[model samples]
Target: MTTVPAVSPAPSAAPAAGSPAEAAAPRRRRFPAWLAVVPLLAFTALSFGVPALAMLNGAFTAKDPSGGASHYTTANMTASLGGAYLTALTGSVKLSAVSAVIAAVLGLLLGQAVVTSRHQTLREAVLTASGVLANFGGVPLAFAFVATLGNAGVLTTHLHLADHGWSLYSFWGLVITYLYFLIPLMVLTVVPALDGLRAQWREAAQNNGATTFQYWRHVALPVLTPSLLGGFVLLFGSAFAAYATAAAMVGSSVPLVTLQIADAISGNVLIGQENVALALSLDMVLVAGLVMAVYLPLQRRSARWLD
Candidate 1:
């Protein structure tokens, strides 16, 4: 002890900020993150981007009727904007608007109820059901509805709904059918917004002597408006793009743009309308783009308030 003091070990040095070790560490970490999204990006490119590009190319290019080379032209685009095509477009828009409005209102009410309920199981049940029902459409759904509400359906036969002029092949009937899935979609979209509502806001409103209606009308509605509009836009796009159910249920009787596109592609209505189908698809893309433009802003606004 008297001879010498014990020597202390030196601390280990960290890699320098600009060192290869430090640089390589981040690269190693980032590689996995980037790799994780590669499959998703590839899938999107293959499924959506490629198809979209092909559609755009086909929309503006027309094959010669006299067995000549294909050439770029605007005739298809012009044709899509008028005549029967225009009628189909207008009909689809009207149908989408009507269904979306009705579904938005009803779904908002239902979501509010689910959010306010005290029962956890009931809330889960409703949400689970909504998730399933929201994705339930196309031919199976069409068949289900037809079996339940068609002219010779169980309900029509038992309840005399057909005799009362309740036809499932009509516009109003399609509206009703759309509501089946649209309302559930709205519920899924709005429930998270409802859940974002802070209890303090309600408490503060009550402390300020605000009634339920007053609180909702003045405070809650303003905050929730963006989300409501966003949900409505989603529902509208869903209804507008829907094809299988409309195709299987009412066929050309509905005069939907989607149905028209199918006719153009299959040449059922006219030969050499394939390019026109692409043009109609382009029109739909433009409409969807406009809708998304509106929806994105509303979504951002809602996020600011809710998040």
Candidate 2:
């Protein structure tokens, strides 16, 4: 032990903050180094911003179909919110709200089945079918529903339900039609969120003697809140913007926003047709804008969760 002199303790490495060069190292920017966003910015400004601004301006300006000069006023907006328009607007919001609830509940169950089932093939097939049906709205879906449930259709006539014949041109019928698309949409929106759940968490919860409800309450539900809200917004927007489906299904019996808008434009309404049409479009924009106001923040928060 005494054969060699004790070696001096190795000098400790200098701390990073102690070195000027290390301390002065430039931090990398969070954004990508190679991305060129100027084109995207320009495109958005031209395509979306310009059109939106123009629409807002047109909403304020009064233009008569008689070739009179345009003047800014609140008359158009006030007329746009008339009783009929208000009724349609309320109908749309209420129907959409109901559809969203129905779709989300059914969709969550479907998503759970798809994710947890052992029969992957069957689940995949069902998912594919749901997707196809979700996009299969417009005139085609209306025809399909009419052919199945209309008075002259096979089911209605053969089953002797003539006394209680279901009219395709009714609000209830529209709700059913909307559900057809909305349910599948919910399945698609929610499946990914369910699939993203970690098996390990469930296992850990079980190992710790947690019940099924406890696991869902403490873990799954919180994680799913964002997706649930986002899906509701998506369903509402889809139902709100839908024109062809509602047009074909109801065919002027029920005055939805889209239906009213269509009538104002080309339904032979001689009174302020162009201006009223513009007003209808503006009304739809306001409703859509309200949904978007809720949508954007939910989307941003969801993105943070993913990150």
Candidate 3:
């Protein structure tokens, strides 16, 4: 038997590294990140952007002194920039600032307390209360404040606050009423951020012989500052834009920007003052825009740590 040597199999050609067959890993690519917010953006544009643009356009438009029709003018801007409108703007700023700062401080303490609490039921109860209170604004809130602090209110009548120089119609009274919801809203905002704080970070700080104050100042606070500031900005905006509460509570006694806008639209007997209301709206929107511009960057920074 002639044993012929088995022929070696012919060498097979290997695929090049760049060839599709050799590319086992799928091509690395990313989905459009903005797709996540597209619906939100769409809703905002339709509900917010459209109305805002219309208001902005109307801000410059004026009644034609000659033709008795609408025409472009700058008088609205000039008028809104000074006089009662300016005073109302300043009042709004002062009130919003005071309320926001108070709410921020109180909310931070409340949030931290809830986060550190051992009782889950207590936490849930507090959060539920907060959620309800945060939404409890506008007419109902005003009514509640009136019932509690008004001249004939339970607290006022029973306690005789009037005798003691307390007045619910005053600026300070408005701040107190605003705090009812603002503090709870701040709690809702900051609690989640507080939750984002990892226990390990605290442990790490402690292992390094860090004191409680040192840990909070160096680690916890830096992470928390952005969220605190963002919440404060939101509270400020909410206060600034509020109308129904102030309207139902104090009316024109307080020269708030919201009141000024409402007056310009409804109560003003002056012809062509409707344009001035739109101008006031424009100013408010500008201020809100500036505030949000500041808040957006802080929010982005905070999200990095929290997320």
Best candidate according to TM-score: 1
Q: lDDT per model, in order? A: 0.93, 0.81, 0.91
Which runs of model 1 end up more than 4 angstroms from their true locations?
A: 1-46, 297-307
Residue pairs in candidate 3 whose N, alpha carbon or C atoms collide under 3 angstroms: none
Q: TM-score winner between 1 and 2, please give it.
A: 1
Top-scoring candidate (lDDT): 1
Which ranking of candidates, highest TM-score first?
1, 3, 2
Candidate 2 has a TM-score of: 0.80
Model 1 Cα shift for residue 49 (angstroms) = 2.9
Candidate 2 residue spans exceeding 4 A from truth: 1-35, 64-67, 162-165, 295-307
Instruction: Residues 192-307, candidate 2: write the lDDT tens digits.
Output: 99988899989999999999999998878778878988888889889888899888767767777777777777755555555666776788788888888987887777666556
Q: Each candidate's TM vs. the true structure? A: 0.86, 0.80, 0.83
lDDT for each residue of candidate 1 in 119-235, tens digit (9 for 90 to 100): 999999999999999999999999999999999999999999977889999899899999999999999999998998899999999999999999999889878988898888889
- Score residue 305 of candidate 2 by CA lDDT: 52
Q: For residues 1-307, write the lDDT of model 3, one tens digit per residue.
A: 8999999999988878888787886677788998999999999999989998899889999877787787788889899989889999999999999999999999999999999999999999999999999989899999998989998999999988899999999999999999999999999999998998899999999999999999999899889988898899989999999999999999988889899888889866465588899999999989888888988887788667655
Kindly report which residue stretches of model 3 are placed more than 4 angstroms away from their true locations once superposed.
1-43, 298-307
The C-alpha RMSD of each candidate to the native structure, in angstroms, is 4.2, 7.9, 6.1
